[model samples]
Each structure stands twice: as C-alpha cells, then as structure tokens.
Target: MDTCTSFKGYGRVDELEEAAFKRKTRNQKIILSISLVLFLVLIIGVVAGTLVHRKNNNNADEVPAAAINSAEAVKSVCSVTLYPDSCLTSLSASNTTDPEKIFQFSLLVVMNSLEMVSSTFPKKFINRADDPEVKEALKVCETVLHDAVDSLDDCISSIDGNQISISKITDLRTWLSTVITDQETCFDALEEVNAALVTEVRHLMKNSTEFASNSLAIVSKFLKTVEENNIPIHRRLLEAKHGSPSWLTAAHRRILQVGKPKPNVTVANDGSGDVRTINEAVGRIQNKSERIFVIYVKAGEYVENVVLSKYQWNVMIYGDGKAATVISGRRSNGTGYATFVTATFVAMGRGFMARDISFKNDAGPQNNQAVAFRSGSDKSIFYRCSFEAFQDTLYAHSNRQFYRECDVTGTVDFIFGNSASVFQDCKILPRQPLPNQFVTITAQGKTDPNQNTGISIQRCEMSPLDNLTASTFLGRPWKNFSTTVILQTNIGGFLNPLGWLQWQASDPPSTISYGEYANAGPGSNTSRRVQWAGYKPSLTAAEASKFNVESFIQGTSWLNGTNVAFDST
Candidate 1:
C-alpha cells in the first residue's frame, strides 16, 4: 500500500492551485508567532534545576528533608508536588521511597470514597427517582462508578512494584486521570436528566476527587525528581499476541452482510431513500439509543456541513467508499473561526463508529487552518475513512479514538489534537506547506501534564505528496507535555533529518514525550533527529507494546463491533 505512486484514489485534492502556497509565509506569521516561538534556552533555569532540592522552612506545609524517608512519607513526597496539603490529608507513610505504594494508597482512598458515595445512591436516590430518564441516567452513573473503581485497581496493578519505570508511572497517571473523567461523565449524564440532583452527587464525590488530585500531584513530583536526577527506567509491558480470528464475531459478520442488515435509515439527494439529507436522517435518531443505529449514505456529493454531537450513542454510518461518497466544506480559522469550530464534520458522541466515508475540507493552504474531521469521540472507531484537507485535516480532538486503514492528507499540522488516539495501518500523506516552511506532521495539544492523552501512530505509512519538496519532520509539541509516539512505522525520505519540529523557541523540548520505536524507512535515522531531553530514537519492544492498540486505548474491546480487520499484533 505504498501511496506515493498515485493520487487518484481517496478524492485527491492536491491538484489545487500552487499560487495558494507561493506567498504563504506572511499568512502563517501570526500563527507561528503565537503557537510556536523561537527555541531559546533559559540558562539560569536549567542551572537552577541541577541544584539540590530545598525545603522552605518558612512555609508551614513544607516537609523537612529528614522526614522524607521516615514515618512522614506522604509529607516528604507532598513537598515537591503542587497539592501537598491534599496529599498529606489523604496518604500516610508506609514505605516512603516506594512511589508505587504511595500512589496505590492515594488511589485506594479515591476509590473507597467514590464507593461510599455510590452506596448511598441506591438507598436515597433510586426510590426518589420518578423520571424514567433519571433512573436510566442513574444506572449509567452506577456503571461509570464501577468502571472508575476498576480503573483505580488497574492503576494499582500498573505501579505495584517497589521501583517502577517512568513509563509505568505515566500509565498510572493516565489511568488515574481517566478516573477523574469518569466522575465527570456520571455527573454529565445526571445533570442532563436532573440538574438539581448533580449538586448532591458533586458533594458526595468531593473527597474522592481531592484524593485523585493528590495522587496525580504525587506522580508529578516523582517526574520532577526523575528529571532532576536524570534517572532512567528499564521496564516495559509484555507484548500481547496478535492476529487472532476471534475478533470478528457472528454479530459483526451479520451486520456487515451486503444489503441484508439494510440500513436503519438512508440519506440520498435524489430522494431515493426515506431522507433527502444526512441531517434529516440524523434527526430521526433516538436520543441515547441503547441499540446500534445504522445509517446508509448513498453515493453523492454532499456540500452541507454535518455535526454528530454527544447524544447520538451507538450510531454507525457507512457509505459507498471515499471516492464515491464525498462530504465537503470550506471553513477555515482565517475566517475568524477557531480551529475547533472550523471543521466540516464533527463527531462528539461516545460509541460512535463510521466506515467507507470521506470527510473533506476544500479550503486551500491560504485558508490558514481548515479541519476536515473533528472528533471528541470516546471508544470510537473509524475504518477505511478518508480525511482530506490542506491543513489541520484530522482533529483527533479528545478522549479515545481509533482510525484504521484510513487516508489523511494535509500540509501543516494536519493530524493534530489532544485525543488518546491510534492510527493503525493508515496513510499519512504530507503535502507541501506554504513556501519556505517545512512540513510538520503532528501538533499534539495537551494542556494538562496529568492528562491521559496522546497521539499514537502505529504500523502506519508516512508518504510525501507530489509538491512536498522540503523535508518534513514527525511532529512538534503544541503543549509543553505533549505526548506522541511513532511505532513500527514507515517514514519516507521526505521527512527531515531532525525528525521533529518545535512550537516555538524557549519551549523545553525535553518535557515532551516524543519517541520513535522500531521504525524503519528513509526518515527514521535516529542520528539526525532532535537531541531533545525526552526524545528516544528507539523504545524497547516491551515499552513499545505499552503504546500499542491494546494498552493505548483498550482497542480490542470496542473495535470488534466495527467489523473491520485490524493488526492486533
């Protein structure tokens, strides 16, 4: 599937005018200035980091160095973290130096607190819940609380050892962050049903949130200590077996059968189906459906923009194929629209799936930032999809998403966002950027250090389109702690020797979690890449597996429903 030879498939848009790129430098000046600054070294700050850590005796909360490894374990670790008071109140000394135990206990407190809140829900809320919608929402909360507890348990298992790798701790932090989100999820559902009820639940979950926040603070302290001491971790997760036939079940097969499952609804411009437009069909969808709703889109050129928001649960959309089914828009950030709002197609719901569909934004390079697909999807999967645009094509915006066998074409920051997403066996086509500037494939936007979000490209192919003359780099950190990994991927010669880009000057390149593992091809030579603080040319096999489909997004559990064959190995 070397996509370099032809541009005919997947609704080629590269044939757009070159004049749009000829004088593009000035157009992007403001964005480059704001989004990225020139890399400058703060010599004093770097030097200060090398000095010995000190406890501020003036501060009442600061723990003394002598108490670090003693019975005051929580206080010692709390001193370095942002939320020391929360840590002190929730955790106590057991094994001061054993970070895993400290973290496990902090999360245990969170789980236990949440469990206590749930115990009262059955006795107080359920009987009083008069609305069926409220009752359904409560059921949703019950399951979400259970899942949050399980996430905490997994975090404990992840960091059970006395000494664990930085990666494992990162995983633990990631899972812990998800626990916080789960509480928000429950509250979101409950608020939709009865906003008045949410205040009570919030009060109940307050301590649990504080405990989780404390655990994350402790983890952040460990990260800082590791950086200060230049410590290295030597552990990784065991790789799971791949290539099993059991993923595609009879349920999946039955749904995929030609014309037999028939669409629950169909959208056709010719009025051949029940609906004349995509929105009409989407409007007919039941809110918060318990069953999968399938929509068939007839072959046509749809010029209207469509948004599939959060309430459309378990909805699936499939079409004739990328070339045959086209949905295009021309919204751009230059037109005073924010990048997030300038998307032609948006999917914000959980349990959303799409196949054989093409999302395109025809705005040229001069349009600044135009997005084809913006996804705030959770446990969502896309197969055989095509995302076409000149810039910011696929906005893997938030939560978890999986794109397999998809084609994404663009120039600057095309595949960018903060979602914990994986693009497996997909084609990332790098087109030419506006003149003078080189191409930067990814721009990960992770605002919070404790967020369990990153962009993982696994076993994918990176190719250069016809006009991509200058070398392109892998990615630049849109945020200080942005995480992105290119694993077992094929990089074309067009990639720059210094395999990554930077948002701006003075951005600490070392704080980013950028790495490449077991990658091959012309652009993968580690010698030429940026020698940043956290850049790893190659990750160990076990470490690489931690970012694979299974561990990254737990892809195995949900991807099966898509009926799409994936490389599980």
Candidate 2:
C-alpha cells in the first residue's frame, strides 16, 4: 500500500511543471511583438526629421536670390530721373543763363525717370506667379535677363561719354549695387519654388519676363533719344568760344549793377548787415533816384514790417541763400495787423526785385488769414525766395510778377491774387488737415486777359504734408476770370483724380481758365480729370505764347548784374 501512494505524488509533480513551461512560452511571444513595434516607430521618426531638415535647407537657399532680384527690379524702374543732374541747374548755374546747359540738364532728368517704371515689373510678376504657367514661364527668365545685360553693355560701349566724373561714376556704382541686389532676390525666390511649380506660377513667370523685356526696350529707346537730342558737343564748344554773358552788350544804356553804399548813410543794426532798419531805410530813400536803388543784404535775419511807396521804382533787394537771410513777422488777421492785407513786406513800387530771402508769417494755423508778402507793385521779380504761412502767404495784388526757384508753403490760397504770375522751379508744399482744398491759386484779374493776368507754374514740384489721397484739385475760382496753369511741372500723388473743384455749383462755366499741359508724374493723369465746362483741357500754341517770362513780368529791366545773367526763356 505505501509504494502505490508514492508513485501518485511523483506523477502530480511532473504535470505541474509542464503547465508552468507552457505559460512562460506564451509571455515571451507577447514581449517580442511589443519590441518589434518600438523599433519600427524609431525608424519612422528619423526619416521624418531628415525630410524636414532637407526641405528647410532648400527654402533657405532660395530666399536671398529671390529677395535680391525682386528688389533690384523694382528700384531700377522707379528711381528718380531728374535729381543730381538737374541739381546742376540749381546752384552751379548761379549766374549762368546758358540755354544749352538748361536744356541738357532738363533732358537728362527725363532719361533718369525711366528707372522708376522698371522696378515694379519683377515684383508684380512674382506676386502674380502663383500659377503653374507662371512658374514655367519664369524658368527661362534668367537667360533673357542675361541677354538684356549683354545688350546694355553694348549700348554703354557705344556711348561717347563713357568716361564721366568721379561723382557720376560713384552714382552709377551705387545704382549697380542696388540692381544686383534686386536681381539676386528674384533669382532666390524663383529657386525656392524649385521644380514643383504650378501652371499659375509658370504664367506669372511668363508675364514677368515679358514685362522685363518691354521695360528694357523702353530704356534702350530712351537712351537713343537722349543721344539724339543732346545738343551737339560741337554746339557747346562754339558757345564757349563766344564771349561769356559778362561781355554781352545790353539793349539799353542803363547801369546794370547797383552802385556802392552812400557815404551819408551809416549802418546801425549790423545783425542784418544793413545800413539801417527796413523801416528806416525805406524812410530815407527818395523816389527820384534815376538809377536802380539796390540794397545788398548780407546773411542775417530781419524781423520787421516794411512797406514801399508807389514812387519807390527800380528798387532791388538781394541777399545770400534763402536759408541764410530771413524777413519774418507774426502779423495775422486778428493779431498784430489791423487788416489782413498787412504784409511783412509790402511793395507798391514798379520794377521791384527780391532774391534769396524768406518772407514768413509765423501766426500758426489758428490765424484765419496771414499775409507773408504782398506786391501791389507791377513788374516784381522774386528769385530763390520763400513765402511761408498757414493761409494767404502771397498776395500779388494787381500786377505782374515772376518767381524763380521759390518755395511757397501754405494751407489755403497761399498763392492767390489778381496779378499775372509765373513760378518756375518752385516748390509748392501743402499743409496737413487739407487735401482737396489746399490750393486756391487765383481770385483772378477782373480787368482783362488781354491785359496780361494769369498764374503759371513751370518746372515746379508739388508736395503735401498729409498722407496721399487721390482727391485733390489744382485750384478753385474765387471770382470770374480766375485763370491758373500748371505747365511742365511735377504734380504730387496727393492730388485727386479730379483736377478742379467748383467753389459752389452755382459758379458757372464762363468763369475761369484752369489749364494743364505737358505735365508729368503720378498726379498728372488726364484720363480721370474733371471735364468742367470752364476748364480748358488743352492750351493752344497761340494761347500758350502769352505765358513767357518776358511777358509775365517786365524782367528785362532789372535781372542783370556784374556776375548774374537773368534767364528770360
């Protein structure tokens, strides 16, 4: 009986051991499956990281070239045409009335303007190139640009004035640097798209290439035009051979240069380099001087009120640069003066000349009306002068005047009157809180147009202190026969599309003559201009003949000096 019981226990122990082994095998299999999944996940993560890094690197590589190219293209197109070259006519041509220099300088400015339009092509194209077609088109743009560059080189080599002054060379070098940067920017942007471009992109590229081509052609044609129109070098040489303006004979035998100071007069206020105060000087001078009476003012500021009688004929005031000499007053409508017509400098004399000085009214915008300078005098001339105020800056009461290289700034009717006036190479700066109503240039001559009364702005620049909004007008007729013309001037983009505004709807058709001719700049768009019944859209050659310097003001009498030859053209 004891042997049979021991055999049963041994069998039970073996069965338990087999069960344990089977359970261990199942657990091992489950562990192996989890380990396999973890390995796969790590491999996937590494692949994804590598792909992201490569894509970022590619994007970075394309960025600089694209940015550079785009910028260069835009800058080259929109650059100024009439800056440094035109500057030659401003200071260096001080007493030089040579027509050739003036014309050449003017034409050079036009050529320089071609750069402004060229810069926008690349950017416009890039912005439009989101389609597959644009991308395809752009793929071959670099080749075309390279060809264009080659053509430019040929043109440069063909030009005779290839060797310019150091300053000119420096300007060209700066321009080249900018061009290179723009070109690289464009290239980089194109590279960023790589081969994954869409149809829209291809189309945009095509358009851009075409635009670039067209712009380059325009530049080429402009260069040829410049070469052809340049008054021949031989003509300049011949002009030099002729005696200078100093040796030219005058039509009249009158003394051109004013004589030195009188021994009787003693200088009191040396601050203004004057022998006497403006009031004292005017008080002393008699109206009967047969020769021209000139007061040569050295560089200083004169703050006083002045008035000249009608008998003070052939009077002249000359100074240093406008910034160096100033004639200022704070008189306004309700302030110091009893009347709004009270001006800082008032002249009723004929043949009055003022050069290189500032006449300012410092009564802030709060003053409704302030007269900076008033000219009741006929045949008045202002050269390199400035008229500054918030309102009613210049009042050319009832005569004729000429302003050359003058700066006129104000908010309302700054340059207004019944006089015939011509402003050449002047700067018209408008003030803030005003856009369409900034310029009220004329109250007009109630007398007659045949009597020679109008306002002409030639080769001037218009600027606004406020932000540009497309709704400004040139002038409004304050009275019937209000006439104003902007000829060969640069109008600012702040101008509204409509060129004129009616003071009121009741202001009828036969009242004014507002004319613009051959004007350029973003503001001079004729397509959207107002078609008012009174405004003359074009000036005929015969009608325009009335607006020359000699006729506008009787400048022939007083513009000559030892070193200065006044330009009548």
Q: Output the number of the lDDT-best candidate.
A: 1
- Badly placed stretches (over 4 Å) of model 1 are 1-82, 86-261, 555-569
Q: Residue by residue across 1-569, what tens digits does model 2's lDDT show?
A: 00110101111224544455455445434433443344333333444554456567855554344333333322322222213222332223222222222223322332333233234444456466776534433533432243234322323333335433222222222222222222322343355345344344344334323323233322322222322443121111111110111111221112222232322232235753446566766666678454566666666777888888667876767666678877878877645343223478887666677766788888776766788898755556676788888777887664556676788877667777666677766788776534343454334433222223567776678887555342446777755556788876788777767777776776545757777876788888878877777676666644443454532332111112222222232
Counted clashes in each candidate structure: 8, 53
Query: What is the clash count of model 2?
Result: 53
Among all windows of 10 consecutive residues in model 1, the one with the lowest summed lDDT is 35-44
lDDT of 1 by residue, 1-569 (tens): 22222111221113232343333323334322322111111222322332233333444465554444433445555554445676677676444534446667777777788778767774477679887666666775775576567667767766566445434555566566666655655675576555478888787787877777677766655544443443322112223222111222333334544432478999898889889888888888887676778889989988878888667777788888888888889987666455556789888666677788899998788888899998866667787789999878998866677777789998888898777888777888999878876677898866456666788887789888676786588888887678899987898888888888777875445678888997889887889778788778887776676566655664222222232333333
Looking at model 2, residue 26 earns an lDDT score of: 52
The TM-scores of all predictions, comma-separated, are 0.62, 0.50
**How well does candidate 2 score on lDDT at residue 217?**
28
Predict model 2's lDDT versus the native.
Answer: 0.51
Instruction: Point out where model 2 deviates above 4 Å.
Output: 1-276, 336-340, 433-450, 465-471, 551-569
